[model samples]
Target: MSSDESQQRRGSYVPIDFTPEVSKQCLKQVEFYFSEFNFPYDKFLRMTAEKNDGWVPIGTIATFNRMKKFRPVEKVVEALRTSKILAVSEDGENVKRIEPLDLEGTKNARHERNKRTVAVMNFPHENVTNMTELQEKMEEFFGKLAQINQVRLRRERGRKFNGTVIVEFKDLPECEKFLKTYSGEDAETLSFEGRKLDVFTKKQFDLQREATRGKNFSGSGQKARSFTGHRKNMPQQEQKDENKEEQKEETSKEEETKVEDKD
Candidate 1:
C-alpha cells in the first residue's frame, strides 16, 4: 500500500491532498465547530469569541486540539472562504458565524434532542486514538442506520475515549427505529469494527446508571450499618464506661435544677 493509504489507515490528521473533497470536509468541520450543537459546549471557543465580538482568529482555531488535523491556518481559511453561514475576514485572519448565536433557540432545541438520543457502547476504542476520526467514523457508521444530528464520543479521565458514544438522531421516529433495529434482542449481533455493541436509549442509559449508583450507595450504607453494629457489640467494660458517663451528666443536670429552685 502507498504511504498516503498507510497514513489514512493510521488515522493521521495530516492532509494528504488539498482536493475539493478535502476542502468540503474542512468546511463542514469548521462550520460544526462554530455550530450551535458544539459552540455552547466549547468553553475556550466561546470565551475567545466573546473577547473578539464573536470573531475567532483562524490561527487560534487552527491551534485547537480537535482542529489539529485541519492544520495550517491557510487551509482552514481557504476552505471557509466559500462557506455560506460563515464570514471570512477580508484579510483572512479570522472567521465567525454570520448568524449570531441563538441561545434561546438552542435551549429549546435541546429538549427534543434529548428525546432522540441513544447511548452506544463496546466500540473498538484502542484502534482509533484521534477523537475527531472516531467521531467521523461513528457518524458514517450510524449514518447508514438513521439521519443523525450528531455523534458525541464519551470520554473518561484524562480525556480518554471510553468505548461509548451518544448519537442524536434528527427526529424521534428515526431514533426509535434505530433502537428497535439494533438494541435488545439484536444487541449481541450488533458489531462495530468487529466488536459487539450495546445500544440504549438516553432514558434507559440514565436508569441503568442510577441503578448502578443505588447499588454502590447501598453497599456503602451496609458498611456503615455494620460499623454501627460493631460499636453496639463493644466490650462490656466500654459499655459500662458509656453508661456511667450518661448517668453523671444526668446527675449534674439534676443538681443544677435543685440549685436554681433553691435560689
Candidate 2:
C-alpha cells in the first residue's frame, strides 16, 4: 500500500473513547440521581447499572426510575428500615424519605420571596401646575387602594418640576397586595409637568435622598396653631366688649331712675 493511503486509513479508524470530562459529567449525573432518591451510594450504583441498559446511564431515565422506586409506598420503606434512605418528616406527621439535596420547597419559597411592596409614585406628565392639584390627583388615584393607611403628597419646584408622594400601609403584606394589584395597570399611569409617573419603593426614596423634601410643612405644622390661637383670642375679646356694653346700660338706667324720683 502507498504511504498516503496507509495514513488515510489510520486516521479514519481512530477509536471513539469517552474523555475524562465526559466521564466526570456522567458520574455527576449518577450522583445527582442517587442523592435525589435518598438511596445509599452502593444501592444507587446497582440501580443505575440495572436500569441503564448497561450503557453507563446518565440522563432523565435513570433519575425517573430511581424516583419511582424510592417513593413512600415503594422500595423507600425497605431502604429506610435498612438505613439506606434519609427520612425527613414535617411536624413529625408525614415523613418524606428522600435526598436532602432535593429542592422540595423551592417552588413555594420562590413564589413567596417574589412578592412586591407599595411605594411612592411621581406623576410628571399630568398638567398639575400647583401642589394642591398634585395632591388631589394623588388622593384620587390612591383612593382605590383600601389597604392604604395614609398618603402624604408634595411637589418640588425647580428647572424640572417633580412631585413626590408617600404611601404608608398597615403592613408589608398589604403593601405587597397593592403592588400586585396596581403595578402594571393603565389607570395607575399618571402624568404631570410633561414627565411620566415614576414609581419607587420607600427604600429607593431614602437612597435618592428625596424623603424630606417638599413636605407639607405649612398645612401640617403651623396652620393648626394659627387657627387655634385666633379662635382663643376672638372669644376673650368679644366677652370684654360685651361686659363694657352691659355696664353702660346699667349706669344709664340708674341715672334715669334718680331723675324720675327728683321730678
Candidate 3:
C-alpha cells in the first residue's frame, strides 16, 4: 500500500468480515460461556464442567467436613428450574437466577461455611453487636458467601462498631477470596445496607514455634565460628610449641615405620 493508504488505515476503525464459519464460531463461543464456570456453583442450580479452567483433586473438596456440595451446572440449573429459582435462554447463551440471598430467610440457615477464617471491620454501629444479630447482618451482607457454609462474625472489644466483624470461613481459599474482593481503600467500595465499610482482613499465623525450631539447643547468641582468617590471636610461643608437638608426632610415626620395615 501507498504511504497515504497506510496512513489512512492507521487511524481508521475496521470491522471483521462475518463469514459463515466465523459466525458459527461466535455462536458456539457464546454458548460455551453460559455452560461453563469455575468453583462454587450453587447446589440449587445445574452446572456443567464440559470446559473448565482447572480442577481440584477428587478428594480435596469432598473430604472437607462442612463445604457446600457442588454438582454439574446441568444438574444445578435443572433443580433450580424445578424449584423456580433459575431462568435461561432458548439458545442456551444466557442465564438468570436468584441467589441464596434473594431467597427468604436463608441468612439464618445452619449450614457450615469454610474451615479457614478471615476478619473484616469498619461496619456501621447500627444492627451490630457482639451477638447473633451481628452474625446475621454480616451473613445478609456477604450474600452467597454467607450461605455456602457457616459464617462466624464476632464483635470486637470496642464501641466503634455495633458490629465490628471477625469473619471466619471454612477454608483458606474462601478467606483469601473474601479479603481480595472486599478489603482495601478502593471505592465505590463494598457496603452493607446503605453504609460503606472499611474492610479489614484477619490473618492467622503460628507464633509458638520452639526456640530451636526442631533442633536441640537453648542459648541466647550464636556459637563460635568454624573458620577464621588470622593466626594473630595465638600467643607466638604457644603456637610454636603446638607446631613442635605435631612435628614430633610425625617423626615418631616415621621411626615406627622404619622399625617395621627392618622387622
Candidate 4:
C-alpha cells in the first residue's frame, strides 16, 4: 500500500504514552487473558484463534478494551516478546501459544486453580465500569496484600460487574496466608474502598452460591463444557489420548488456512 493509504488507515488511532509500568501491566493482562485457565471460556479470542491456527494478530489483541490503553501497537507486541507461554509469529505480526493448547489438560488446570483461589465479594460494583478495569484494579489491590496469579471479576448475565471476584494466588501458601489473615473474625473489620468486604475460600463461595441459587447452580463450569467438549470430569487414559490426536488434527486444518491480516 502507498504511504498515504497506510496513513489513512491508521488515522483514527490515538496512541497512549508507554512506560515501564504500562509495559508490565500490558504483559500481565495479556498473559492471563490467554492463559489456559481463561482461554477455554474466552469466546471472542477462541473464535479469532480458530481463524488462524491459534495465531491472533497483535493489532487484534491491542483492540481489546483493557489493552487499548497500552497503545502504540508496537508496545503491545514488544511486551509479549518475553512471555513464556505466548510466541510471536515469524513475521512478528501475529502471536500464538508456544505450543498447541491441551484442551483436556484444562480440566486438571481448573482443579488446581481452584485449590489456591479465594472469592472476594462486596467490591462496590457501581464503581466498576468494566471487567477489564475491574481486573486491573483488583490485581493492583490484591498484589499489595499477597502474591497473586490472577483476579477474575464475576459478572452477571448482562455482563455487569457483580462486585464479586475470584482471586487466584501464585501458590497455596500465599492463598492460605491471605485467607487466614483477612477472613473469619478479621473479615468484619476489613474494608475495601470504604465498604466492608466478604471473603471466602473457594469451598465457602460455592456453598454460599448454591444456597442462594438453589442446589442446581452449576456455575460457569457447566457453561465452559461447550468449549471443553463436555469433559467435566477426567476421562479414561485411552480416551484422553484419542482426544489429543483429534485436537491436533483440528489445529492442523486451521493452520492450513491461515490468513495474514494487513492491518
Candidate 5:
C-alpha cells in the first residue's frame, strides 16, 4: 500500500459518542501546550486521554500534533490558556474547592419534625348545612380522639359544608402507627350535624379512588338518564317507552277529531 493510503487506513477509526468535538478541541489545546513547553507529543496525548473519561480518539491527538507544526507555539499556548483546557496553576491549590466532604463527625439532620395529629371523620349522611356546623362537628369529634394535635377546616365551593380537616402529628411515624392500629376499627363515635363521624386516613382516601373506578354513575338507575354505559344518541329503554306512549296519545286525539268532523 502507498504511504498516504496506509496512513489513511490507520487514521480511519470509530467516532466517540460523548462530546467528540470537545475532546478534539481539548486534544488540540494539549498539543499546543506540549509544543510551547517542548514536551513530548506522545506523553501529552497519553496523559490527557488517561485523565479524561476514556472517550478521546487517537486520530484526534495525531491531527492536533500535526497542526502544531504550522501554528506558532507561543500563540498556541496563549490560545490554549484562554480556552480553559489547561490549569492556570500547576499545583491546583487555587482549585481546592473541589474536595470530598468531611462528614466524619457530621450528624444527619431531620428534614421534618413530628407533632400530634388528628384524623377528622367524614360523614356522608350528615346534613351539614354550613361551614359553621361542619367546623363545630370537627372540633367536637377531634376532641374525643386521644393525642389530638391541630385541626384546620376547609370547604369547597358548591359542596354543602362537607370538607376535610388536616391534622398535624408530632411525628409522621406516630401518625402512621395510629393509622395502623385504628384504621379499620371504630375509634370514636361522634354525632355531628345529625350524622355519625367515620375516621379515615389520607392514604385511605387516595386508595378509594382506585377502588370505585367505573362504578359511579350520574343519575339513579330507575329512570332512563344519560350515565356510564348509555350514549346521548342511544336513548334508554324507559325513554323509548315514554316516547311511544306520547305518540299513541297524539294519534288517539287526531282520530277523535276526525270522527267528530264526519258526524
Candidate 6:
C-alpha cells in the first residue's frame, strides 16, 4: 500500500457504517492529528463541544475543522465524548449542555453531587395492573427513592411522555442508594418491576429536555447552525411535536415567573 494509504490504516480507521466519503475524510483528519501532529483527540472533542455550547454537531464540527460537511462525524466524535479524560464546563441541550455528564476531572464526584434527580426512561405511561400502580411501585421500588421531592411523568392524550420519569431525590445519600444498586452506562436502561427503564441523572434529563426544544446549540453570541449534520429533511410531524413541547415549556416558565413576581 502507498504511504498515505498506510497512514489511513494505521492507529485509526474510519467506521464502516459512515458514508464512504465522509468517513474517509474524517478518519484522514483524525489520523493526521493523532499520528502526524500527535494532537490529543479528546482535547479536540472537548473544544468542539465547548464551542457548540456543550453539544457537538457533526457537520458544524467539520466546518470548525475546515473540513467538508455531509459527513456524519458523530460516530467518530462518540469516541472522544465517551473518553474519560474530558471535562464538562457547562450544560446546553440533550445534544446541548452535556457538560452535566462530560465533566473532565471529577466525573464521579459531579455525578455524586447530582443527587437532585434521577431519570427513568421507557417507563409505562400508566401501570396496566392498576391506574396508580406506577406511583405505588415507585414508592417501594428503591428503599429511599420513594422520598423524593417530586415526580414528573409527563404524557399527552395519545402520545407517551417519551415514557421518561424524572424523579428528584430528597437528598444525596438517597440517590447514592439508587445509583449503587442500578446505575450502568450513561442513561443505561435497567429492568424494574417487569419493565425495562433507562436510568440517568436529572442533569442528563435536562440535557434531553433542552435538545427537545429544537433550538440551535451554538454558544452565546455565535450564529446557530443546522442541527441535522447531513441536512436531511426533518419530518413535518416531528417538527410540530417539537414546537408543541417548546410552547408548553415556555408557558410553564412564564406562569412560574408570574407567580414568583406575585409573591
Best by TM-score: 4
Per-residue lDDT tens digits for candidate 2, residues 126-163, read 45454434444665667666565445443333312234
**Per-model TM-score versus the true fold:** 0.69, 0.28, 0.28, 0.70, 0.29, 0.33
> Per-residue lDDT tens digits of candidate 5, residues 1-263?
99999987665444333244544554453543333112221233335535653223322433442232322222333333443334323421111112222322111111131123433444442354544344445555555654543444433333333334545454677676666555544444444566544445543332231233344311123211221233333322322354554454233223211001111
Question: What's model 3's overall lDDT?
Answer: 0.34
Error in Å for residue 33 of model 3: 41
Give the range of the ten consecutive residues with the poorest summed lDDT in model 3. Answer: 218-227
lDDT of 3 at 201: 37
lDDT of 6 by residue, 116-143 (tens): 6676665554534332345435545643
Give the least accurate 10-residue stretch of model 2, judged by summed lDDT. 254-263
Q: Which stretches of candidate 2 lie over 4 Å from their true place?
A: 1-118, 125-127, 157-161, 182-196, 210-263
Kindly report which residue stretches of model 6 are placed more than 4 angstroms away from their true locations once superposed: 1-115, 126-131, 143-147, 157-162, 186-189, 214-263
Counting only residues 3 or more apart in sequence or on different chains, how many pairs clash (N, Cα, C under 3 Å) in candidate 4? 0
Clashes of 5: 9
- What's the lDDT for residue 101 in model 4? 77
Ranking, TM-score, top scorer first: 4, 1, 6, 5, 3, 2
How well is each residue in 1-263 modelled by candidate 4, as lDDT tens digits?
99999976764367877788888888887886677756665656788898998998887777666666776778788888978889998777998888777766774466577779887767777655555555566778989999987676665544556666778899999998888888765443557879767677775554344334423222323322221233333222322354664454343222211111113
Cα lDDT for residue 135, candidate 6? 41
* Model 5 regions more than 4 Å off: 1-119, 124-126, 154-157, 173-181, 185-196, 210-263
Q: What lDDT does model 6 reach? A: 0.43
Candidate 4 clashing pairs, residues 3+ apart or interchain: none
CA lDDT of 20 in candidate 3? 50
